[model samples]
Target: MDREFRYTQKDFNRARAFLLQLTGIKLADSKDSLVYSRLVPRLRKLQLEDVRRYVDYLEQHPEEEEHFINALTTNLTSFFREPHHFDILSEFIQRGEVVNRVWCAASSTGEEPYSIAMTLVNVAGGFASSAQVIASDIDSNVLRHASDGIYPLEKVNPLNNKKLFFKRGVGVNAGKARVCAQLRKLLEFQKINLLDEEYPVKAGLDVIFCRNVMIYFDKDTQEKILLKLLSKLRTGGLYIAGHSENFSHFSHLMKPIGRTAYIKL
Candidate 1:
């Protein structure tokens, strides 16, 4: 097949290996096309001739790592992507488990964390409660998008009770909506790379919403990150995982509550 710039298997391997070293994420051989697509823009920006040159440039300029990660990281999510998780969170709060603070480990463009904030507000029967959502992602680009709190209208409209949490856009901003002030105020976005030895979050969080992101990591890396995440949760605090990810093998550390939701032991 013809392409815009020279790309080869070795180039893909080196790029993916560097990605794994920086982010603890694994890309399969099937991801070759994806690697090509993501890196092509970088090649153009740097006036490079091929993927190999981009890889070498990355090696020499450590600061380029941020743009490299931002370009490749996927942030496909929506409000209440897995609706059941929010129900579980509501239940966790209702049971008086002290859900005054929560963490969204992969907040991706804001939907999940905003959903979290909405749930907390609804559970409290209003916005009067003192609760906060610590939203984080390794991808700085998505973090900025999340912080801006603007999204297409179609994405916001399908959500139940959206009027309570979102403001429809107008004029030049039509066909989009912004998360309401109440919901936006409850969140604090941060850039956090899961591969780091120590996270900056406080210990004893009330709930952690670290969903599908773990699927990108190998088993050992998954386990290592899970333990570090659990250490942040208070005993009996809620831990929610994506439907595609399961932690039943680690039952000794968590009690299965509902679906992929767990109560940290």
Candidate 2:
């Protein structure tokens, strides 16, 4: 098959290796097409000859690394995705747990963390709750977008307290809504590379929602990140994993409490 730009096995291998080294994310052999589709735009933007040139440009121009990672990293998310997790959180709060400090480890476009803030607010009956949510991601671009707290109506409409939590846009801004100041205030966004030597987040968090992120890593990288994340979560605190992410292998560190959710031991 002919593509607009030159893409070879070597290019894919080099790019995937760099990505793994920089982010602890492993790309499978089947991801060549995926890589091409995700990266062609970057090549066009940089006016590069091919994927090989893009890889060389990445190494030569360190500033290009961010754009490269942003291009490849998946940011598929929706407001209140996996509603059951929020239900579990409500139950935890009702059961007399004071969940004050929470972390959303991969807060793609801010939906997950914002959903968390909404849940905490609902449980506490207002914005006066002591809960604070720290939302972080590896992509700087997505972090900025998440910090804005603006989304299309399609994403914002289904939220039960949409009116209370978000303000509708009108005129040129129609069909969009921005999270209310009260809702936005509950969260702080930061750029965090899971592969970092030391996680900059504070220790002793009450809950951690690191869902769906471990799937990108290999076994050893996953275990390394999980251990670091667990150190930040207090014992008996809730640690939520993605639906497909099973932590049963780490039973000694955490125990499954609900669907793909864990309790730090």
* Top-lDDT candidate index: 1
> For candidate 2, what is the lDDT?
0.92
Q: What TM-score does candidate 1 reach?
A: 0.98
Q: Per-residue lDDT for 107-155 in model 2, tens only? A: 9999999999999999999989867999999999899999998899999
Task: List lDDT for all candidates, in order.
Answer: 0.92, 0.92
For model 1, residues 1-265, the per-residue Cα lDDT tens digits are: 6998999999999999999999998999999999999988889999999998999999999999999999889899988889999999988878777788899998899999998999898889999978889999999999999999999988988887888988998999999999989889999989999888999999989999999899999999999999999999999899999998899999999999888999998
Global CA lDDT of candidate 1, please? Answer: 0.92
Scored by TM-score, the top model is: 1
RMSD of 2: 1.0
